[model samples]
Target chain A: MTITLNNRIETFSPQEMSITQIMDEKSFHFKMLIVKLNGTLIPRESWPLTVVRDGDRLDIIHLVSGG
Target chain B: MTIIQNITSHLSVKKAGIAGAGGLGSNVAAALVRSGVGHLVIADYDIVTKPNLNRQFFFADQEGQSKVDALRENLLHINPKADVEAHFCKITALNAGSLFGSCDVVIEAFDCADEKKWFAEWMIAHYPAKPLIMGSGIAGYGSPETLRVQRSGNLYICGDQRETNEKLVPLLAPRVIMVAMMQADLALELLLQEKPL
Candidate 1:
């Protein structure tokens, strides 16, 4: 399955995965993250339960410090 | 037509809420006030110190003063008629909405990744209709050309997008204020675009 992650399309073998699994697989280990799946925000508490299907568009933003 | 008259006529009735009164917050608040934003709600629990003088808006004389108080004083000095509300407390998911609910736009000027994430998420979740201006990665001696503004829905993020480790590079005034001014300009632009209810 192919999906756009941060505007870059990538293929995944599993075809489906939880948001948490996707983050872990992609090494998005940053403590500060804003995850949006197809324009809907996935709360931190819901990452594990939320599943990302094929063709989904994910926007993963990292906000850092210094002002 | 005088600049002050034009600014007052355009912005005398708008209100802005700044989440942190540090380098970005103080400078953003000052620019908004000078532009004649009618009211401001500024929050911060930290105190000014000698090191803050390098980039923050507080003067050396303001050392040891609470950031919210010092920032309010400085803003008032700029526009005495400006209604400045200072809150000396840490903003969390619970109180962020209530504290800034009445504001037309919210500015995120936090000093930590966790705080920025929390505030952005909370605002996006609870206040979906409001505009949120945030900053990230304004540290060291980065070139001005690297800075850029990106927007997604109601969220506008302005910064170099390069994470500068504070330990490795000190936060300087030029980059910090440049991003702050970007946030301020975006806030004003959003405010101007809104049609009165």
Candidate 2:
């Protein structure tokens, strides 16, 4: 399984895992999220820790202050 | 609207330590005293100058007075029963801990962001139970409505979204005083076990 981490997700695993499972056991501190899969932006809470398939392009977006 | 009948009830119980006895600090100390805050520990290494009088509530007669002493005098005048402890030294990392040790809440009314960050982190790390209220971004003469509140755990932050614009609106006395009152009010609510203001 190939996985990628972007933004502040370097500590998160990209392997096959559910987002719910990852958040339930690992980090509950994060209050913002928008995961991307293969150039498609996933919903704010849909990113799972499941195994990442090939050709997946991940982009993690968080809130920023000021323009 | 819980109107505290005995204003001195909780005011006499907890002490509030105020850092940066300049414009924001002066306003904070005065408001705390007026609100009957029990004990207030104030620290400021600056002196009153002509320009500081434009916004700061100190008297024109106190031009050369130490900011800490002037603040103490003014606070006592407003509330004589309150204990106003003034430290003429600056609130550096060396002295921040001791100064804020007994304070139930620490107000970082510092103009400089770096200094405020240092005090906030130090207070949170050393006094995890005591809350740290910080000021930020209240720069221009824009909407006081723009002043928002941000809190993560025990650290609370207020002020503008960006730095002040010296030409357009450079945080005047009215706005700074308004925001300072908000900070003081929030601190009192937290200390007195009342709902957030």
Best by DockQ: 1
Off by over 4 Å in 2: A1-67, B1-3, B165-169, B194-197
Q: Model 2 over residues B108-195: C-alpha lDDT tens digits?
A: 7876655665565567557867787766655555567877665545666666535444566565677677767778888877877863
TM-scores for every predicted model: 0.85, 0.71
**How well is each residue in B169-194 modelled by candidate 1, as lDDT tens digits?**
99999989999999999998888774
RMSD of each: 3.2, 10.2
lDDT of 1: 0.88
